[model samples]
Target: MKILDKLPYFIVAAFAWVAIVSSCANQGMPTGGPRDSIPPVLMSTQPEYKALNFSGEEVQLTFNEFIIPDAISEKLVISPPLESRPSILTKSKTLIIRFNEELKDSSTYSLDFKNSVVDNNERNELEGLRFSFSTGDVHDSLRVAGKIINGFNLEPEEESLVMLHKNLHDSAVYTLLPNYIAKTDKEGNFLISNIAPGEYHLFSINDLNNDLRYNEGAEKIAFADTLIVPDAEFHAEADTLTQGLDSMLIEGHTHFSPEPFFMRNFTENIYEQYVKKAERETKYKSTFVFNETVIDSFGIRPLNAETKDWYILEPNEEFDSLTVWIADTTLAANDTIPVEMSYFQLDSLEQFYLQTDTVELVFTEKKEESRRGRRGRNEDDEEEEGPEPVPQFNWTTNLSSSNFELNNDIVLTAPQPLAGIDTSAMLLYLKQDTLQTPLNFNFTKDTAAWRTYRIAYNWEPETSYTLVIDSAACINIYGITSKALESSFKTRAEDYYGSINLDLNNVPGDVLVQLLENADQEEVIREIKTDEDGTVVFDFLAPDKYKVKVIYDRNGNGKWDPGSYQDKFQPELVSYINEVIKVRSNWEWKHVWDLTPDPTFIKNIRDKELEEQQRKEAEEDARRESEQGTNQRQQQNNMFGPGGGISPGSLRPSGR
Candidate 1:
């Protein structure tokens, strides 16, 4: 309500009017000149120009503008490398390099700055800067170039090591020292220059341990297989040895290592051998035979029990064999009993000998003494039963849902919850047709309480099939039996399929591509390798939604390699394109993928060879100099008496 409050409204109105007038005046008016395009320039060197026989410990290089340091040591190659690594400082406009070791005498040293200097703002690199100087004459100017490839996939392996050895032999570089080494760039290309050429053994290896040596176990190596020298050219191809997959379970019986078991008599031995006859039918079973000594002991036990009307044992006197018999009226497929012998002895020498079926008999023995006082009795004085019998579960499948599609996961839903069953005992099988025998199935338990189970099959299209769930295949908790079940179905036609094409960028040719269906994301539909152009295509895919994945394939192997924590190798980089495509009938879908770069370190072959040659020359020069010094000393000693040995006294007396 004060005059000041009304005055604020009037002031705001006046300011708004003034802003509108100013906006009208500034409309379409030119602001400033064009942006400056001047590149960064070098200002000065700390030691100044052509500083003769510069003996300073450090050199400072200053630029007109701020800059960032690239992989300095890796990108910066020093000919006649110093014993100690030079420290590079980039605190401000000045870049300083401090040397801790003395320089070689009368030698030309060249520092090849390969893309290690870049401007701070736009990261524009200054490539191929050479700093050359000589204490005596001129610098060496030899060069070498080569490509690096992955040992496993036979494709370009970026960031691998390419080394050169002065001495050539299969085991030389692997065991002995290498002269020099360098890392490959992202394109798997390398170049090394400023070298004094010499006979060298060129080798490329993925030195996983960074030991600068070709470790046969830890590194994959490729060599020219001969001595190489200046102006010589050669190509080396690296490939990995294929590893074998572990054995798969074929039938119900697994291979058994033999154990010793004694038999009561010849009849018992024969019975024991016959009991395992079914084991021979298994695909992986081997022939088994009982030792002669084991057979002899089987004849020693007394066969004292008499044959009853319900159970009988018939001996074949001529063949040393016995036939177990049960009265036809009481005998059944599931009925079984343990044969008792008159004599009590260790039965630990039984040997299996036979070829019949693939079924194994596993017996669980119950000692009478363990249950002696625990027997129960009824109120009427009759002994009560030990325990209630467990219920059995048997499965039956509808043929219509049995045939599996590549895109669709087949599910078997139980009609009711199973009771008192050992679900683990159940076996599933598939058959090409009703007339053909069944093939073993690898099934996994899905839900115990629901009695649900699932099996994933790498099924092909248009295949007729039958599924079988056998009776007596599963034993209940109380050892009750379940009846076998089976079904049959034919797959749909193959015309309902499609194909997919993937175009990948920045992806290695060795990258692995996998197709997965939407229904079972964890299940793989198919796996393919990317071509050199980074393109992967999957044909004959069933109609469904699918996802694509690309793995870096670090070893260039056509598969993903798992990382080991102990080795300190991180998991191979993986990228998912995340494009969900619905492949319809007779349709084709194309996808493009730009893979992310992996963190990798590789050696350059050309640089390594060049460095090796330079190192050898340096060593040879040092050796020659040492020999000359030794000879000069000996000559001086001879000129004077050995004891006088060019003493300062001799030189002073001559001057006086």
Candidate 2:
């Protein structure tokens, strides 16, 4: 009873404590006064910055405000990089850097702390805090700056390591660490300061292992064609990759040659080619997946079975996967099958060697009762006992509607590969005003697909046509016959379609112009090669919005080839015309596409769209990760607590 009576006193005490805390918080809270726009100011340094002949392992930098030291390990750039990273600790408002390894004597050392430290109150970053000292009397003070981007998409590559190597051999990137290094920002912009004046080989790599050296076949790289010499003269150069940095400014010396050099990064096509896996997903389908593209010279054969045309070989467009459909039912019925797979394997010195391995293909399906029962139910909701339904012979066609498109073929697709297709049982007739007349048409199976057949005929616009197929017209490999099908559909009127006449400006003739259904390039609607004058006409496009991409077709293969670095070949250059052609009925849209390669133009057009798309995907990914309890993201709200992180919405330093 006495404790219950003291509840009022406790409540009063809590209220008093909250008032006192709120009074303390009010002093630091924003109150419409001039916002704290300035970053933490440097007060002094231990051993003083730029002290010569100093033999010390510890350096201290005191700031005007209490600063966080958490991001030092990641954002610090110590050139000539320390073999081991330095440790950073804070005492009151001063940060101390302790070297873990011995520094090279008689050499200039630069400690570039790029926006790692932030003020305690506002969390404002101290941007570009650079300190330099030399064991001897000399200090290097030159730099180089550039932007890195993906060669294919022109997308800016963030966090890419830009390296400067004095040893200009091609093997330097393979065996040695960079003399000086800087990481690209979100806009792919990088600035390496306090570099010694000398000619250097500049290269950029994604640095997958953070070993500072570019591991061929494991990393994407970009390099300068010519040696770059750092200078101290301020050469005016505009940042071309992005406009995001206009919001913030930075104090920098323009003592760099080729300011803002555009580097197009590319990943080599040489990766270890191993048998990724061998699996039999279906009774008749056995698939072999390779880690890299199958170079058309690979071979596979059954280890203990007949090798004479025992299976049908089907490779995907990328040639990375091969589907082996069993021709012999006896072989497919077996529970497991062994096959010898031979493919090219890469060596450490970039030489190819043939590797053979035995792989077992296994598949077994467990049958279970259907969770989804019959559509109709009994009053008691009991399982209805009835005769089992017969297996259906499944087939589909492109004629989904009565109004068929003139540009489309009446494609017939089976659920499984076909054993035989009898075109003699199929009939097509053209419907006139009242009478119908039989027409000659070619019904042939597609070379690439075993189960797909197309009925090709001269379809007259605004004319009705009738197609009839007998019950046994097509038979699958499983001995199931197709059901009888009949349909009367009318070809769309000529006015219902649209036409596109494209003039490929600045492009050579015979270039392939592909009509893409979407920006992702998952599906290509139509493809046409330009004429000798770089002109092409697509006369029968349906009224729909479409995107256009041009394939250079350098090898005259008529298909876009993903290039090989070992062969010194680049993927057929594809240029996307950055506009959606909204075709309306009875319209002829003529457009002149500029095929000239302008990465800056593409980057500018794609920046907002890419950011929006990535943001949506990142949000969805974050939500899914959070729901799955696997997200490890940690936020540092250190104003009233302790955190070393400077996250988004925190005060970041100016400039990319």
Candidate 3:
């Protein structure tokens, strides 16, 4: 009986322990006192930073906390870079690096670990870690700072390799590695410190093959036309635009010459022109494609058929490709057709020659449907066949609805290549109170479409109209004529459209302003060229979101062009207004775009804006993590059992 009395107390104590264990299990890993936001600090170095007469092949860095060398091979940049990558290892809080190549004598070597080392637990990144040592008695200490910019869009090019060449020859970029090098950070900003003061040429290479040298046609490169001499600023006045910049000191009151260099990044685009692909996809069509735009004579002809006009030639806007539509019925129905293609082919010596070849094009089919009927029925089926489709010409129109948009044209398209259209048999009528009135319209061929024709008419707003095309009005190359076709539609009112006017202040010469469909700026809805007064207007725009893009047509070619590195010409810069230009019904929006700032000024401000944007993103991420922690605690405290009571399942503790 005494033992039984103690059992009641034992059961009560067990229940109390169970409740505590359940609470802990649901809480997840403990908060552990906020987080380790502080990055690892460098406490000591092997031979002391900036030490002279450095003779060892190994370098070591000890930090205040444990560290991780995350992707050190890729992130560590050493100038006068080594021919081969070094081996990097971490032990506890120390990072050790062993060089594989010999170091240059009487030269200063600097290693920049741009945000590669991080604390062990929280992965806090240590930013802008640098170390310098010299093989001789003296160490170089001058610095140069600059940025790499995309030539076309004027955006910063991030993580590009900035190189300084002492040779200064044009061929040095292709032959030798740079004397001093540094990599751009996430913001496309780089600083090469501990450089010996001397005249140096600046260049940036994307380095796809990791050779540290520029490879034409395989890498993107930027060069500074003028050589840069790194010097210190003693008492120079700062520019007004740089008032918001952080004050950086090299020595005492010393700055990086107070003038940042800007490098224009571009591709040479000297890819050799060659046929990329050629194939016949259907019974009636074949396509041929080339790598680049064909600036010379390019032609294709059907060799199997004897008829002169065997196919209709259709060239893309770029003129680098052709779509051949077989017009001859015999050639179109052939199982295999031979065709001859002639085009300019580039040789290894960069010379073009007219080359011709004849090849056979054969159509293919999937295995399952190889012997099946048109409707996927087995060929051996003994079912009665239905009547064949009528031999009428297949054609379609854009009139899908009763209401018509004001900006659209009445288009008619046929499946096969069209031979001609009998305009005399076409009729357009104005329908009022069931009374038809003949209206004058133009049947014009749309240059941008294939096998298509457009009907041009000055349609009255809110008025219904009927269009009639008699039989045989449209004839295809196969001698088939279209059947009768009639459609009725009402034009939209003027109140459904909007207008936009732009006042371009301090505009550059020969500017092409384009209004886009959205902020993506992929499709241009309307475009206008600014006159000498720098004013352009776009009238009768439909209600939609829009954006504006301006291209500086420097060559007056009516389009934007990329730079030619060999010609020493920079690409024309493009500017964009990113605000959502919303067009509402019957509203006219006017905007004054100030183009006073040059392209360089625009690029510099854009870099700062991106920096501020990244800062806000970092803060938002921290807030979200904090809220998640609080939510987890609340979930632990409010957790309920499956059936509303602390039953066996809910009483499950940590281990048992």
Candidate 4:
């Protein structure tokens, strides 16, 4: 009876052991094989690579492993560009390219992957894969390679479109698309392959609207005057292989050894003339603003012949702008002034033509309007019109030269016209211990600028002085009284400021030298045009680190012109000296720079900057890749086996 009762317990123990073993078998993960490191390999093509007389509607490429396309449309470059971009599709491990436009007869086509294909799981990229096909019997195996640089700064022009023109006419680039095109890399390097062996014109443009046309004044352009022939020598060489299936022997490829062509980019600014606006502040003054400075070939005539004598025309140096001063004081205050202006204006075709415009000038607030009442207004109704507003104004003293150059005088400007001043209420004193010495000074209005006044007194270095003006000391044209004012200042010490003596070598006349503050060469502290012998001196500069920039003025204009494409002008060259000069108190810093063009020196500077940028990007990519690998490994270890094992099926051989 005891043995039979223990039988149920034994059966229960056996069932419990079986359940525990089954659970353990299902819980553990399988150890995976080595992590995938090789990129997808191109096994075969439907119409073999470099296929001659190809007539297929679609091209197919079979890879050893499944691939995921990343920005394939953007990275793929098609030579002898199609009217419509082709469509790309993937089915398992095969990549399909469907033509959207008819292929040109007797033309060679090159499709470049530019490393857009990568393995699906590990995302390892395949580099430098290309396919070539010909619609006729033979293929053009030549290439044109070059570098593009900014004409002004000599910096690398990356992402610029380099084009080849078969028309060979200068005007053709403005209207037609290029025959073949390639984009410059970060290092300003570009190579267009499978070009026919013939003379071809080369040009580069930013292609802002992606139209491939040179839109005047809207895009930058770089052109090569001489035609190019793609007949350079090419040699075959074996490519270095990586680990895994990539280590297998591959066919050698031919590489072209072409002399690098250098190009400079520039933009043209064509002049457009038009009267932007015209302003009339008083009956005596009229200001005409042109799109640009106009110095001649423009006229303003009064509608009434008798008033013509009053017009005094004066144009600024720019020649695009002008101001008219009327000397006639007998004109009525509220008169409707009619005037006719004739000038050369730019038409839609950018051609200059004589155009006339009639304008009725309006002056809302005139000095005479406040002095006289309307013709029908009664004197008794003045109270209803409200008491005239008190003529209020602000005054500013031109202390720009207050650091007190010996030749500078204290200049004060008032918004309103000044009539007279009271010298008795004004005092000047030299600040001395207890006994302040009284100094003699003179005050007078400036002849040229009627609203400006000059206060003159002899100044000595390191001396403090004070000027005081009592209230109502000065009177204005509207009989307004002056406000009380007091000013005190001391001359700077002789050793407080420094100087810079620059010796420019090989300067092509009309260059501008500027002393710039800060490390970025901004904030112009002082600037001057080059004198004879290329000598420039800057005095009275505070202690600071300064940089120098020299602008090569090509047109002998005082200002630097960026450039204009329509005018066939290149921007003036700008050269920066490498050193940051430290100016010390009471010290003079002398610098010598050779402005002569040095091709090698300019290239080295640009190359160093490019290398630094590339290094940082490479480091960032490596860091991300390392992190991804670590996270993947950790996840496998936790979910699968301890050694991060994967199922055996995932390690199926990638047949190449």
Candidate 5:
């Protein structure tokens, strides 16, 4: 063995050292220890928990370990809640609570440390720890519990305030704070304990601003119709976990479980009347929007009515909106006209009272300037001015096809609000075989929509119809004339429409089924009411994807009512058949809806359908991959030729 042999051994030693160092570096930094799970434990307290005849101003709690006050001022709840929140402080392992108000006589007060006391280092919460004291001789121990959910959608409402009130007045919920309040948990469960048994009205409010009182616009509220009396019996039992039989044992008390109360919180939009805004949509047409519904048609006139008569008013059916037409042609483009409008509006008390508002009407954009071509001297002398271009207006319709159905109306909308209609210039013709016969039709303005007109005729199926409107058939507020337009449409065969047969189970007294485009959009294509047999047939439905929503009409009113808060009523229950029913042309879709089912049962059906669809897609993808692999193998065989290919006697042909 010479120097060369020694070099090989040295290289092997160097590699081994590098591998060991690399492996050691991969271990990274060391973790300290297992996580801390034990929360802070109470060692002692001044005037200890459940102290009787307590009149102290400050409570000092000492813990076994160092504790931190994590948002104790906000998280610490004093029940019945104090007039003012108390100040919380920490000194080493001790927590101090200083009450700013005097405690009531003979009343029990509980300071709930709802996870506010945490270990200093690990931040483990001391959950559900409470300190209770009676200012008088003994404590008044009674409990009430309930749950809260949204009125329309049955989703749990968290952090809502459930309160009790002794006063039976209907206005008490609006004017005064509650006697005892408890916030709802994440599951909408609430418990109010240590209450003196008495007759009390129960209500729940969102209390969004934390003002304690119910606010009409900012809060949602729910109330129970019947007065609740906390009379459930409770007894004490020996503590098994804390104390042994040989040790001095204290008893732990448990209350009897009562029928839990359920409340549906709802918000009402009280009638408040005010104009939202007035905007000029076109050159001579302006629209007005109101916060509340209007009772009558509004009057619009120029401020100087004696000099200007350009404005005319049209009120929509809902009375919440209206359009104003300015017919004065002398008004220049891009100009705004000031006018005063008078209308009957709802006041604070919901009475229709007359009110007036001033609005500014703006005109449309100015017309474009025309360019002139080069002209001879004679042509220039003759003045190359052409007749003023006709003010052009276009009309469009909401009809999907030229052939309108007997059930559908032909609605046409104008570019500007029309002041006058020339019905004689509009004609309808019925095409029977090869002969086109003239027919009479009536035109009426649709009061529900602005600048819309409906043409009605005795339409018959299996017949083609053509509608023709000559130029100047309608005159706008600016005196603009509509262009001549003609359209032809044919009616569809009766068999082309789809039908739906629904057999409902566990149906409420009255059921209202709404056929919607989808679950998310909620666009109702049609709605029908069914009888006790829970049988409903919806005919003449278009071929599309749809969902069925069933409303349990609890009040037998034939409609779903969102419950009134002050009236202490629960809203009507509603559920949807989550299965997406695809109705093809000339097809009939039938479904059975079970009303008395679990809330998530419909969602499960939808999820199962989705999973099945995914499974089919996966199989199709695998088939495609297999075909592609076969095609590649065929190409390889062709490239390699017969010599390189498998022998016919030994190989099997591919199967299709």
Candidate 6:
């Protein structure tokens, strides 16, 4: 009752309590800032600042801000590492490091804080902060500086480790930490400070295996032939070391090696007829058998059955042997099929070699009879039942060459010798630009079974010329009319010519050079190989600017191949210098290319182009959607506006 009488005082007390609670909630709230400003900066260390004869088990460091430890283990590195890792303690911005093992009696130790210490707020790293302590009276402060380059391209290889070893043995790097070590930056520059003056072997390693050691099979190592140290000034130049391919490893162990040669024999005189019919009819069965130990896989090259021809077949992949299956009807009854087989194998020097062989097979009469029985009877039996007429032999004109330049001499070759043909019945005409001209012919025998007649005529440049053989030009042994054939080709002008010269310098002693033009930019101009002088010349090229490239054919295989990663084989490093030489009329452009070192600029350009293409595609898609939306809106307006039978003024609001 007495408290109720003092209501005004009680109300005042309650209001004051509410205000205090609201003020406390608004003040001192967690705003995600550090508990204190000035993140962990090192002030001073123990042992009285560079005091000599220091043999302390515990070292204390004072900082200006509260410290949190996360990357202490990875960022901290102790030179001549201790048997065990040290312990770090944080007590109110004071970091204390306690050694867990005994140190050498009179040795110097350096602690590198490699981006380890960071502020708690934004995780700002402290760079290049190191502390040095010595048990001896003197400190080793001598330094060395240099750059690390890739031996292949003479370009700086970033993040490469440059190490110095007191001993040059293989196990030195594996067992002991480098006496002095530094990593190359993006510019390939490195500096090792506080190195003890001594004779040391210096080398740079890619360290792909992360073992901190050199493995020729897994790592690229650049070593100086001589020793380097703090007292002696030296520079280390690196070379790209290429590992050879091992022949012991086989690729795709499933198939046998393909044979280079195969043969199909025929008894009947159906060479031309069978070739024409076989091209349309895909019936035939052929099997290939080869040495499984010598090759990996094989394929058959296309052949001309009418005229005994030779063709080259390339292998698909690496294998000991390969078997190919072909249909039997591809050959005539008396035709012989010639084949070339390609094989791949590793040589003793750990290099790959492509081996080729030639083989042949004869088509016999028995095989032809078996094929006829396998082929079912056709509907043509009704027409053949009426009368058995004498088979008519037909003669056809086949130009031995299908494609030719206008500068080349025109030659008409016949399949058979013209002995019984009437000379007056033959008519040959050559025409160009509506101008008909008669060509004088001179007959010459090529071989015992074939003959050719040469037609002389001066071809005009940049003009399409056609040769026509009228019907009944020559009669065959069976007295049939010859089929008329026509061929046409446009002549190249004198202005369409150019040349290029390659000058290679500092080439390896046993390397072969191959020059290749970008096919997408130009037609198949030509391919040339370099001589011992490392020079290749390409003449009579069509007038065009082309992308030129070269390959250091290390194995003399006459081809370029990408090396394998598992075998520790670096690819055949190709280079495109990006120098577009314009080949003009009557111009001999000489390009001095030194392919001794590989180039990576082309790869960079290709990657950039790929990114640009992707970006353009995205932009095009956005534009296409915008256009589609515009078209849809226009169609909707046309359907509802004036002429579309829905007047704008007559339309009313939906709510109304």
Task: Compose the digit string of candidate 3's lDDT tens values, residues 1-656.
Answer: 46666676667668886766676574677876987799999999988999999989989999999887866777999988888899998877899989988889989999898889898898999888898899999898888888887776567788899999999777888899888999987667889888887888888888988888888877788877777898876664555665567963333356666378777688877757778888888877888888887656787776756787777888887888778887777777777888788888778786888878887888754445434465576445635555555576856898854658776789998887877888988888986645666688878887987777898888777778888889888788878789898888898898988888888888768788888776332487777776354668887788887767788888887877776656777767777774567788899989888765355644322234456779999999999999999988766555544553344454333331
Q: How far is each candidate from the true structure, as Cα RMSD in Å?
A: 29.6, 14.5, 8.2, 10.9, 11.0, 20.1
Q: Is candidate 5 or candidate 6 better by TM-score?
A: 5
Model 6: lDDT to the true structure: 0.54
The top-ranked prediction according to TM-score is: 3
What is the C-alpha local distance difference test score of candidate 2? 0.76
Candidate 4 on 292-345: residue-level lDDT in tens?
655566877767657646655656566676767655555425366787888887
Candidate 2 residue-wise lDDT, 1-656, digit = tens: 46677677666666665665566452564677777878999999987777877689988999888887878878888888778889989999889999998888777788878788888777888887888887777777777888988776557899899999999777888899888888888889888877777889988889999899988777898877677988877655555555576554433445445666877778776566777678898878988888889766678787888758778777887788888888777877778888887888878887888888888878776665555443655645554565565564857888854678887888888877777878888888975535545679988877766578899998888888888888878887777788899888888888988888887677664577888774554268888876355667877887877777776777787776554434544445656766677777899989887776443444443334457789999999999989655423232134334454332323322322
For TM-score, candidate 1 versus 2, the one ahead is 2
lDDT tens readout by residue for model 5, 1-656: 66665776666666665665465342757667788889989999988787889998989999989887756886676777778878888888888998899978888877767678889888998878878888988886777888887765556788788888877788887887777877887778777777777888888899987777888756788777778888755476766775655675667556544456877777775557778888887766678888767755466776644546666666665568777666675552437777787877666666877888887777658565434334334565446675667877889886555435556678999867776888888878874535655687777888667788898876676668778889998887676789998878777666667888988787656778888775554677878876576678878777776777777777677766777764556667777766677777789988886777332222311534557899999999999999999997876666446765333322322222
lDDT measured at residue 540 in model 2 versus the true structure, 0 to 100: 82
Model 4 TM-score on a 0 to 1 scale: 0.64
* Model 3 ranges off by over 4 Å: 1-30, 236-252, 302-306, 364-387, 396-398, 424-433, 459-471, 483-493, 517-521, 542-544, 594-597, 601-656
- Model 2 misplaced stretches (Cα beyond 4 Å): 1-38, 43-54, 125-131, 233-256, 295-307, 343-355, 364-392, 402-406, 427-442, 448-450, 457-467, 486-501, 508-533, 536-591, 594-602, 606-656
RMSD of 2: 14.5
CA lDDT, every prediction? Answer: 0.53, 0.76, 0.79, 0.74, 0.74, 0.54
Indicate the TM-score of model 5.
0.66
Please report the candidate that would top lDDT against the real structure.
Answer: 3
- What ranking of all candidate models by lDDT puts the best one first? 3, 2, 4, 5, 6, 1
Give the TM-score comparing model 2 with the true structure, all chains together: 0.71
Estimate the TM-score of every prediction: 0.41, 0.71, 0.79, 0.64, 0.66, 0.40
lDDT tens digits by residue: candidate 6, 1-656: 46466666656666665665465343675778545434467887886545567788977777666556678665566654566779987777776778998877666676766667777666766666677777788776655566655433334667676677888675675566677666666766666655677777666677776556765444666555445645533343333332254433332322211211111111111111001011111112233434333343343454444433222122223332232323233353324566555555446675666656555544444445335346765658546556655443334333333334444555555443343544444434444445555555544433322344554456556666566665666664334446665666666675667778777776653444433354433333455666355667776667666656655666667555444322324445455546555667778877676656542332221334446789999999999999999998887677556786444333322221
**After best superposition, candidate 3 residue 323: deviation in angstroms?**
0.9
